[model samples]
Target: MASRLAAALLAVPSAAAAELPAADLLIVGGEVHDGTGAAGRTADIAVRDDRIVYVGPDGERAVHAARILDASGLLVMPGFIDPHTHADGDLLSSDPDRRENPAYLHQGVTTVVIGNDGGGSPDIAEKAAGLENAGVGTNVGLMVGFGPVREEVLGETNRAPTADELARMQRRVARAICQGALGFSTGLHYAPQTFAETGEIVALTREAGKRGAIYDSHLRDESSYSTGLKASVAEAIAIGREAGAPVHIAHIKALGPDVWGSSGEIIDMVDEARARGQRVTADQYPWRASGTRISNALVPRWALDGGMPGLRARFDDPEAAARLRTEMAENLRRRGGAETLLITRGIGDADRWDGKTLAEVAAAMGSKPIEAAIAILRRSDARVASFNMDRSDIEAFAVQPWVMTGSDGSTGHPRKYATYPKAYRDLVTSGKLDLPTFVRRSSGLVADTLGLTNRGYLEADAFADIVIIDAERFVPRAGYANPEELSEGVVHLIVNGSLAIENGRPTGVHSGRVLLRQPSRGTCP
Candidate 1:
């Protein structure tokens, strides 16, 4: 079958070698699932100068071309665009081949949005250039982080931003957008940012808006009964109103037993905002649990008042340490207890601690869960996954037409390899959702939400970021116990009209770009 498909692709037309040179590559004979909200069909795809030139039935005449790949008996579709990710530092470090990222590509993800949670390198342009120079395996783009910028300027202290500070932040945001940031992101749940008054964030969002950028955020809280969940959503709405930027809630979730069925309310709120002329959207991973830092679960906003130094000082002071522990104990109960948190990544001796329930770790240490939480925070900094989401809530949010699918995952979680596949296996193959609806949420909906042009559909003249997989054999190989395994059933992947992956394997190609936000274009920037 491979040989036949290769022969069929080789038969496509090409110009003379000396004059303009033959096209870079051609792919033919596969089931094409254009990222559009449409069904799959068999078609031929041609590439010239890294852009898709033709997409139709393979013709009869055999013509010359530079390279060709066969994708017969495969499920071909648009390479996935992960709207939420935190792979910026990973892409810049020594292991930039990003073996973890291929787990995404093998599952049909060709492009990813990094710099999420308001935590990205300060120099985004440099980081983008470095990734391109080092030959990245997947397309990478980013959003400037409001939290990090605040941390850099204010050192995690709680206070209102003076007028000068606000201006400085806005200028920084504009520079980042000009340097290649798709938008601005915030993590109001984390420090320094949590201390920020609503008006400051609104101001920053407006700066991004002027550049035609979007505003994405991990809201202040997702589980609390009082102002925690609602206030966070309101904050994002407010930012959108003031900034004139589209508001995108990061990893929209209804976590804990307390809020098991709160998805409807959240959706209604977003709808209300939209009714008021505010552009709001959200993304979610297909998982029953959410991951984050241990400190995030325990450390009080006041305890972490002075950045790392302040926290370290409090850890050493006996009286202050006791007070910190007491506050953490209350926070643990508020967050559904230590049993809800699981260690995912750790350093040194903590490596053996991964996958253990926080309760188990506390028991082994002969300490209370709150004490154990403090110990882990002091020892490993913040690197834990909290099992806080409700399964019904996950399913409810996923089916929303306006709610796009995203792997709110990192290299540490199986969702990095399994989010889309898991959705396909459980939702579509199991009959919970039709194939077209699933594809619409995963591809077209996300593309449309971000205003990405020319790649979501398989029509002529579109950038060919495509994927092909086997529906029957499709399954997520990664699990919570072994979170790094690659997925199965992805037979081929094409990015920007180039064969980036073939037969469930990476072709080691580096044909991606840093997409920035510009006043002229919506997302291709």
Candidate 2:
């Protein structure tokens, strides 16, 4: 290892290597993938404090180092940034297991974008302060959420916001951006956001645009439920065009049999929008199955109009109850039938139904599958891995230039623990995308999408968030049956220049920082 590292040191121009500041840690003799969809090169990177000071051929003479890692024969790249994750809730947990965030580390992730799907509070400063104060395993970035703001203003009411209420919501968004929120995020498919009209979203996103924040959203409808897949995408594009900020579609997918092969259509929509000078992009998970609640999968949007009270009231009315069952049955069929739904973590009596198919659970309960799903939803919010996406659609969307990779959630599915490595193995290695493109889509592209000026690359003066992987050995160990298992690939992981994982294991270090979105220096294209 020493001799191989010496070769890298000898490879640099002697003059360029002379007289540099001492580095806290030095990585030598690695295949450097700079995260720009470029070819890899043999290079060494020197880190001082939390920034990369040198990223040239020779490092031994370029900078003095207290600690030197002999990273020979490994692929050193910018640590991946997950665009959407549910891990933010775990950052403040008392349980060590959750705080450690082993799943993220194992998959070579050094940064996580949290408060996605409109779940984070609009009080972005307080949330960011709390996580930083508590200390996290990886870098955390907060996206001010629309759900909490709407819930606060409307209290789950299925109605458009009054003009005064709209002004309040706009003020909240502007305040969040000033407080260092990356952008605005909305899960319009979920209530009370579902209650929001298109004009309402356009108004809110316009506020985000004025503050130079991205508009991130979980598309309103991905199936045949309401606007349909194509129209939902158009809605997102319309928001971006009217708001005048870049729009990001969270977890872009052609979900359900009805929407399968719709990725091509989505691409065309984005392309046409781009032609019209609209900045539109998206992120996707590698899996064909998407994880969500049973209630969301079965219940019609109209049935959930007025929150729990309205839903229960409708159930009490015989006519409404009959209609609810009929619509829910159609919704179930649109999801490719109950047999396609796998109960990953069932709740209450449904706990016994975990790891079972909806078809099997329904048989066990001596009821029809749709009826069984409705019963489970009535009892508790059971989660499932719905295997409705087509492989062709997955590949079609993933291969797009505007698309990046993300793990929408971190439970009941292998994606949470294994999305990056799985994408590397299945997509890159399988020739769907080359290694450089894969790294670019996952890292630099994501950073660019979110306007992260100082991260997602192994560049000088950039934040020293890095990953070293033994490509031959890097593989995801997590599976459907064992979704929480740690992946095996990241032999060394560094968060903000501190070693967080070594030799394919965590080093018990919590050196993460709260990364905030930076305002652009000039007008953006």
Candidate 3:
């Protein structure tokens, strides 16, 4: 099949070669996937400066080059673009190595979208400036987060904002968009964000919509939490409809056992919205367990109104404590069972809980599961790998053309380092999806969804962000037990025309750029 596909590449005119100038680097004789859902073709690509100068057959003979990278017998394509990630913790860190982002570099990800789940800083300009000054390993795109916008105006209280406060929040969103934010994002499932009504979100989102920014959201509910999964998806669509903004769902999934087989229903909702001429898209990771803090998985949002101090105060009150315990027990049941929650990371003495299931920790502590969870949270909010998704549902979403791949990459989860390769192996290699489809979703599709220009494609005038992979070796080594393990199989990687990884090893080059949105014409002053 591979031989047939390669042989089918007929000689086409080298139009780009004739028009382009001399090349700095020429990559030759690779099975190229141009990131447009087209079949693999054996071709050569030429790069001069930060843009791809030419891509055609026999580029070595047509264009003169200073350096030649032999990508023979390898898969060459656009580097993966992750649409949702929590990489801000590493990208903005004081440590230089962390800023280099070796974990994602090895996974073939060239750009990552930060400030996901509504955790984006309200000060997008300041954050972009900081990352620019501090060299990073991959290109970054920023979003104006709803969490910080709400908190900046109305503390972390669980109440609707007054008209004046709502106006202030709207102004902040307008300011962020003008400052080059891609859009407004919301993690409606989290505290503070969870307190906002749909009306409040629409009012604020309109500011971004008026400026032609997208509305990306971590849905208000993935399970039976507050609104059901289907209802929450409807809400997201409605918000986008009312605000006149494109909707991008972050980590779209049927999260817990109670919602295990609901991916089909969720997909239909998105499709129906798209059918109505509404722009709606979503991203999903190829993993059974989703990574999050234990507190977020089980604690009620109202109980966390005043943050940790308020929660501690409630624990001391017998009546409040009893209610909290009852609700927590139900939440635990929704997430499968205590045994399904594996502690992945913790701080101080709580670190001892790593690698153990919540049920196991409860047994060791000689207490009920909810009590054990509270005890662990009291010390430190430990991160957990909650195994709740069903395999059938994952594949159902994977086959959808509108759904792209995102890592939601956070620490303590293998998805941080393995999302791209794992998706390739599971979806493409397993015959669930073809190679072209996989490359398209991981690359060009994401770029289109986010309104990114001149990236996520291997063509003339596009940024030279490319990945060369040994297909056999391109599999994830990371797992729940060893979450930080760097992925294998990327033989070469180029970020903005600089070799960041060569011959399967990092070159320690931080050539990544901080990509900011260009405000639509007639919208910004």
Residue 335's lDDT within candidate 2 is: 88
For model 1, the stretches where C-alpha displacement exceeds 4 angstroms are 1-24, 58-72, 316-323, 520-525
lDDT values of the candidates?
0.75, 0.87, 0.91
Residue 50 lDDT (model 3): 94
lDDT of 3: 0.91
Compared with the true structure, what per-residue lDDT tens digits does model 1 show for residues 370-479? 77777766667646677777777887777776777788777577887788899888788878777777776777666676656665666667777777778877789998
TM-scores of the candidates in the order shown: 0.90, 0.95, 0.96
RMSD of 1: 3.5
lDDT string for model 2 (32-122, tens) is 9999999999999999999999998767877867779988899999999999999975787876667778889998998899989988788
Model 2 lDDT on a 0 to 1 scale: 0.87
- Put down candidate 3 lDDT per residue, 64-170, tens digits, no spaces: 67778888899999999999999999999999889988889999999998998998987988999999999999999999999988888888889999999999999
Assess the local accuracy of residue 195 in candidate 2 as a C-alpha lDDT between 0 and 100.
Answer: 84
Return model 3's CA RMSD, one decimal.
3.9
Better of 1 and 2 by TM-score: 2
Q: Give the TM-score of candidate 1.
A: 0.90
RMSD of each: 3.5, 2.8, 3.9
